[model samples]
Each structure stands twice: as C-alpha cells, then as structure tokens.
Target chain A: MIHVVRKLFWDFEKEEQWLNEMSAKGMALTHYSWCKYVFTETPKNEYTYRIELLDNVPTHPESIAYIRFLEENGVECVSSYVRWIFLRKKSSEGAFDIYTDLESKIKHFKRINTLWNSVMWLEFIVGLANILIGVTNYFNSSSSISLVNVILGGLLILLGLVFLRAGAPIRKKIRKLQQENLIRE
Target chain B: MPESSERGALTEAVFYILLSLYTAMHGYAIMQNVKDLSHGRVDLGAGTLYGAINTLLEKNWIRAVEGEEGSRRKEYEITELGKTVIQGELIRLGELIANGKRIAGGESK
Candidate 1:
C-alpha cells in the first residue's frame, strides 16, 4: 500500500485545512507534533512504505527531522518527483518498482524546470523594463518623474534580477533531487 | 465562515487545478481545460497536475463527484468555498482592470 506525508512550505493554516479535508475523504492520516503529515495506504506485513507531499520547500529543521526519522528507523528514504518516500526491505520487485517511481519523478522535475524557465524569461523582461524606466526618468530634463519613482524603479529592477537569478538555483535543486534518485540506483 | 485573503494563497499549480475544475471534470479533462484556458500558454504536466489535484482534494475547495471507482480519471467539482474564492479573484481582477482603464484614459485625450 502507498503512504503519503506532507511537509508544507506555504501557509500553515491552509495546509491544515487541506490535511483535514483529505483525511475526511478517507485518507489515512497521522498528524505529527511538527508540521508533518504521515499517511499510509493500507496496513501490510511488517514491511511498510510511506510518501510525503510538500507544497513549498521545507525548512532546515523539517528537513533534518525527516532525514533523522528515516535514519533512526533504518528506512531508506528516497525523494523523487515532489514526494519523498520511505522504503523497507521488501521483495526485489518492490525495489524495482521504487526505482521506476523515482525515474518518473525525475521526468516531472524536468518539466517543472522547463515551466520555471518560462517564468524566469518573463521576470527578466519585467526587470529590464523597470531598469529602463529608472534610467529614462533619471536622464529626462523634465521633473515630472520623482526621484522616489526612480529609486522604486531601480529597486523593482533589482527584485526582477533577483528572481531571474533565482531560476538557476531552482534548476540546481531539481537536478540535485534527481541526482539523489540516481545515486541510489 | 468568510474566507480570508490569506487563504487565497493556493499555489499556482493548485489554483490552476481548481480553476480547471470550475466544472465537473476528470483529471485529463481538467488538464485539457487548463491548456485551453491558458491558450496553450500553460501546460500542466501530468505529475504537477496530479500533485495539485491531490492537494486541492485535500483542501476541500474541490470535491470528487461520481465516477468509475478505482479509475484515475475521477471527476471533481468546485465546492461553494471554491466558488467564493473564484468570485473574490474575479473581483480583484476586475478592480485591476478598472484601474488600468482609468490610467489609460487619463494618459490619452
């Protein structure tokens, strides 16, 4: 049976609402003391498996908690796609199945990166426009444009550049996640 | 209870999934709806779409309607809560458009 856990990055209240709703719909859920949602598909033999779904990137504490949990339990935790799963010593077939799932996750992350790149292009254009607005206002002899506007525009340009810069890190994280799956295989 | 503006912070992927399910629709159908709505500008990858759908279901903004049991192509509908959220978004967008129109008019003759 499949298991699901969630480490939310977005609004905690919204996340709680989501967990409650999902639980109401017959999902087996165990709300941990921290912001971890542990769910299992069906009770099997001594061997059990679990998965986690997180909307936003988890905090360092949450990450450490998750890793530590797996390490202490001796369960092999693999993160692929957006969900990370814990696997126990099961049949060879189960191992093969897990690998397939990880591979599929890698494919999904690639698609996610592609979409992010598109957003980055849009941010870059918006940033460039802001910079131009600032530069044009500064160069203009007319005093219609306030110094504050120029400064705001410059800040906006900076923000856009930061977002544009953020795309690479996002890409790197996805690649790193994918690599984790590969290293296991 | 009245929804909070903070609650409107659904992820882009999740919001798109909810938007797609404004009508009773299945996974593939909702995916197609998003593609069409975005004029193909937004393509919801299967994994992303599935993940969003699962979260949406968990949020109660979207609920599953009757469909083939054990089938992945389960149909879903926007709840009253979901509709309220959508209305709020529409109003917000309307305000933005009106402001833009006023600004553009002021800039012109």
Candidate 2:
C-alpha cells in the first residue's frame, strides 16, 4: 500500500524523529518533495531514517560523491530537496548514526546554524526593501496597492523575525557542542 | 610556516584514515580497516569520513588512485607528505608513552 502525507518541518531533527515514528507504524518513506512525502507499507521497524543537509546541491559533484559513499556504506539515499537528503538503513544495521564523534557533530550543527542565519538575513533584506518601496509609493500617491504592499512587507518582516527566533536553538546547540569539544575532542 | 602549522596533532579519525589509506583502499574498506585497527574503538561514520577525506585531499595528504575507467568505487592512498606527518605523530606518541611510564612507574602492560 502507498500512503502520501503532506506536512512541513523547519527542524530537521524533528522531521527525522517523525519519519522514524512513521516507519515504526509500518510506513516506509519512499520519496519526498518540498512539503510532500510518499510512503510504502512495510513491516514495522524495518528501517531507520536520518535527515542531513549536504554542503552542496544534490546534483553537485561533491554531493553526488558523498551520497555514493553513503550508499557504499549501506545507507540508502531516498530523496532530496535542495541540499537536504533523506537517508535510511535497515533497522537491524546496528545504530546508523552519520556522525560518531564530537567534532563531526559540532560541524554538522554549525552548518545548520549557518543556513538559518543566511535565511534570516535574506528575509530581512527583502522585507526591508518591500517596506521602503511601499512607503515611497504611499507618499507619491495614495492607493490600495500601496496599502497592500505595506501589509505584505510587514508580514514578511514578521516572518523574518520568526526565522531569527528559529535560529536561536541551532546557535545554542553549536555553543553547547563547542563547550564539549573544548573539554573532550 | 604552513608545514609547521600542519604539525599539530591529528584528530583520531584523520589519523586512522591516513593509516588505512596507506594501502590504497576505497571508502568502505577504509572504514572497516579503521574499525579493525582500533580494535573497534574508533568507528567512522560515512558523513564524518567524507568530510575528513575532503580535508585530507585538500591538504594533499591523500590522493585518489587512477582506477580503471568507469569504475564506480574510487580508491585513495596516502601521499609521501602524509607518511612524514604520521611518522612524526608516532614519535610524539612514543615520547608521551615513555614519559608517562617513567613518572607513573608501571610495567608495560
């Protein structure tokens, strides 16, 4: 049986956990695109899922090499969205963790932190530009278009603030990992 | 100065990886070799191994072997410079062991 689920997640870790939960319920994720997921029915606990953000787009040579390496190691690449890849291995494979050391874990979180930081800045710049244009339009001639632009600009800024807030936990994770790295590896 | 800077201690993963690549092995073979060499102490995850391999390649510590055309599995081997670095590390480890044994006063176990 095939099942399709429509959902969105900004937190990769949470998404991984949710996918594992779905697998536990006998739904093995077969594909993913943006906010959509497709699954095939399978025996419960047949697979373990992991989500990783590649350092480059999936088609990039480096990314392809990395994926091929994972495949050689028994991890299957199920799907990709932008730079993020969904991976899985048989549940009986004995703890399929992609990062086994403190340094690697720290590096992974730092990558995620950099991503969120870029997103927040991009939203802020675009939002500020829209607000500036809307204000100029309003002053030049009063119109509903100006009001609509102002409203949309305000919403974008608000979304930017949300992204900024979302990045806090990732930053906190990086800090914690760095502290641990200092004491250990 | 760059050579001196590179003399700093290597991470456990890098050390094992370089050691494993001395014989020109592919990725999965390298992982297994590391695990066996460490007596199951140091296991390299695929992602971590990929990152370390890239760094080593950039540093010219390891080079890809020219395999038969169209071969999907690529092999890597340690460079001469990499051998020098690992040898330096061995001497450093030996000194540390000798110092600890002299001060701690324990039989070599």
Candidate 3:
C-alpha cells in the first residue's frame, strides 16, 4: 500500500522523523515530491532514514558521483527534491547518521540555513513580480483580475516570510554548537 | 612567508582519516581502519567521513588512486604533503601526552 502525506516547508526535520516512524509501522519511502511523500509498505523497522542538504547542483556530475559513492558505502539514495536528499540504509547494518560531531553539525546546519535563505529570496522576487503585474492590470484594464492578482501576490510574500522564519531552529543549533566550541577551548 | 591552513592542527576525524590513508583505501575501508586503529573509539560516521575526504582532497592532502586487481571503488592514498603534516601532528600529540603524564605523575611537585 502506498501512503500519501503533505508536510509544510518548516517541517523538514519533523517530517524525516515521521517518515522513520512510519517505517517502524511497516512503510518505506519509495517516492517524494514537494510537500508530498509516497511510502510503500515494508517489514516493520527494516530501514532507517536520514536527510542531507544537497549543497551542489542536483544535475552536476560531481553530485551524481557522490551519490554513487554513497551507494557503494551501503546507503541507498531513495529520492531527492531540490536542496535535500533522502537516504536510507538497512537497520541491521547500523545507524544512518552522517554528521556526528559538533563542527560538522554546524556546517550542515549552515548549509540548510543557506538553502532557506535562497528560497526566501526567490519567493520574494516572484511575489514582487506578481504585485507589479497586478498594479499594471489595474491601471490598464480596471478589472477584477487585478484585485485577485494583488491578493495572490500578498499571500506569496507572507509564505516567504514564514519560510524565512523557518530557518530559526537551524541558526539556533549553529549558535549552540559555537558556544560549545568556545567552552571546549 | 606563511603556511597553509591545512598545516594547522587537524581535527580528530581528519587526523585519523589521513592516518588511515597511509595505505590506499576506499571510504568504507578507511572508516573501518580508523575504528580498529583507535581501538573502536574513533568511529567515522559516513557523512563525517565523506565531508572529511572532500576537504582533504581540496587541500591536496590525499589523492584518489585506481584500486588494485580491478576493484571499482575510488581508493585514496595520502600525498607527500599529507605525510609531512602527519609527522607534525604526531610530534604535537607526543608532546601533549608527555605533558599530561608529567602533570599527572606529580614529578614536579
């Protein structure tokens, strides 16, 4: 059985955890898309999932080579969308953790934070364009479509702001790690 | 006039990884070697190992080599610069260990 679920943008970490929980309930993620996941049934707790932020272009040769390298190291590249990739390994093999120490953790979090910042900028640009179009339509045609466009543009900007805020937890974690490094020093 | 950033103190993971490359080995083999050499204490998680390998490659501390006997995986071996750095690291570690023993042994008191 394939299960479908919708997750919000801010829920990246939470959604990874939830998918693993579903694995424990006999499901493995076979496919994924923005805000949507397709999991097929499996033996309970057979796999463990991990999310890694892809800091390179997805279609780059090096990126493809790195994915192949991971496969050779026993990690299955299940699916990826934009800046994140979902990787899983058999539970019997061991944990699926990649970044174990604080320094690497900080770097990882920083990458994720960069991804969110890029997304926010993209959304803000699109929203601005939409509002400009709306204003032009209002002056040119004086139609209801202008009012609708304006509302849609405003909503997009609001969504962008929310995603910008979604980066807070990652930033907070980076700060904590830096503080620990200071203490250790 | 100045040394490279790679000449400074290496992190624990990087240190072990470079040491493991004394013999040409692939990712998984290096991970296992580090664990065994460190008496199971210095385990390299896959992600950490991956990042460390890339950084080391960028620093020219290690290079990818063809595996022996038709193996397919990318094997890595330490470069000449890596050897010099590892020697420096060992001397630093030796001094640290000596100081730690002297303080704990109460020889000065």
Model 3, retained fraction of real contacts?
Answer: 0.55
User: Which portions of model 2 miss their true places by more than 4 Å?
Assistant: B1-5, B66-71, B101-109
**Candidate 3 chain A: worst 10 consecutive residues by lDDT?**
A6-15
Which parts of model 1 have CA positions greater than 4 angstroms off?
A1-185, B1-12, B68-72, B104-109
Which scores greater on DockQ, model 1 or model 3? 3
Clashing pairs for model 2 are none
Chain B TM-score (each prediction, in order): 0.75, 0.87, 0.86
Candidate 3: list runs displaced more than 4 Å: A128-145, A183-185, B1-7, B104-109
Predict model 2's lDDT versus the native. 0.88
Q: Which candidate number maximizes DockQ? A: 2
| Candidate 2 B-chain TM-score | 0.87
Q: Between candidates 1 and 3, name the one with more favorable lDDT.
A: 3
TM agreement with the true structure for every prediction: 0.37, 0.89, 0.87
Across residues A29-109, which tens digit of lDDT does each residue of candidate 3 receive? 988888888889999999999888877866778778778878888988899887578889898886677777778888888
The DockQ-derived docking category for candidate 1 is: incorrect
Lowest summed lDDT over 10 consecutive residues: which window, candidate 1 chain A?
A: A91-100
Model 2 docking grade: medium
Model 3 / residue A61 / CA error / Å: 0.5
Q: What number of clashing residue pairs does each candidate have, in the order they appear? A: 1, 0, 0
In model 1, what lDDT does residue B105 have? 55
